[model samples]
Target: MADALTRDGIKYMIARLLENANEAVEESKENKDDAYCAGRKVAYYEMLDILKTELDIRDQDLKEFGLDIDLENKIA
Candidate 1:
């Protein structure tokens, strides 16, 4: 089996995935199928959540990136 990815590796991949999704959203703005694009974006976000869980990423991890999200409090 392949070795597991490091936390940094996962972070890098997450960023890349988000960037690709954002670009798709921008391009999709010109398309007529908004619902399909929105659905795809939701799927991408769910994948990000999976990666976050795989790394056991929490509020503190996000704080390191300047994202002051209160995961426990449902605030940001």
Candidate 2:
């Protein structure tokens, strides 16, 4: 099996991907075709799909990256 990536890495990239998606939307604004707008939307959805599949392969859930899992555990 390949090395397992923690949820943190996944989340970080997801955020970055979202930023990219927003940029794509801005670029799409100039395009007149509804098809281009639809395609741009699909790009974000595709990124989410890739992220989910990668997480499944790594056996990592989003909850695991609570971002402060350690802090929460310590507070408890």
Candidate 3:
């Protein structure tokens, strides 16, 4: 089996995913494209759900790394 992720590693992964999602959201708004925007929105929410569910990282764990469990607030 693959090795478990370190706290730092998990934090980094979550941060990167969030950043990508935020960027996609911003691009969709700026471009004002419907089709691709829909896809980007789906990808962003899917990633957010994975972070909340599949990773199962606790709120305190995120706080320890100066992150927040409130991902919707993090979205741009």
Top-scoring candidate (lDDT): 3
lDDT of 1 at 66: 24
Report, for every candidate in turn, its global Cα lDDT versus the true structure.
0.55, 0.58, 0.68
For TM-score, the strongest prediction is 3
By TM-score, rank the candidates, best first: 3, 1, 2
- In model 1, which regions exceed 4 Å deviation? 32-34, 49-60, 63-76
Worst 10 residues of 1 by lDDT: 67-76
Residue-level lDDT tens digits of model 1 in 13-69: 766876766665565566647877766666665665565564455534653332233
Per-candidate count of clashing residue pairs (backbone under 3 Å): 0, 0, 0
The estimated TM-scores of all candidates read 0.55, 0.48, 0.64
Residue 76, candidate 3: alpha-carbon lDDT: 28
Ranking by lDDT: 3, 2, 1
Model 2, span 1-76: residue lDDT tens: 9878765676777667666666666666667477877587567757655665665677776454332223212211
What is candidate 3's lDDT per residue for 8-65, written digit by digit as tens? 8877877787778878778777877687875886677677776676444543554554
By the TM-score metric, which is better: model 1 or model 2? 1
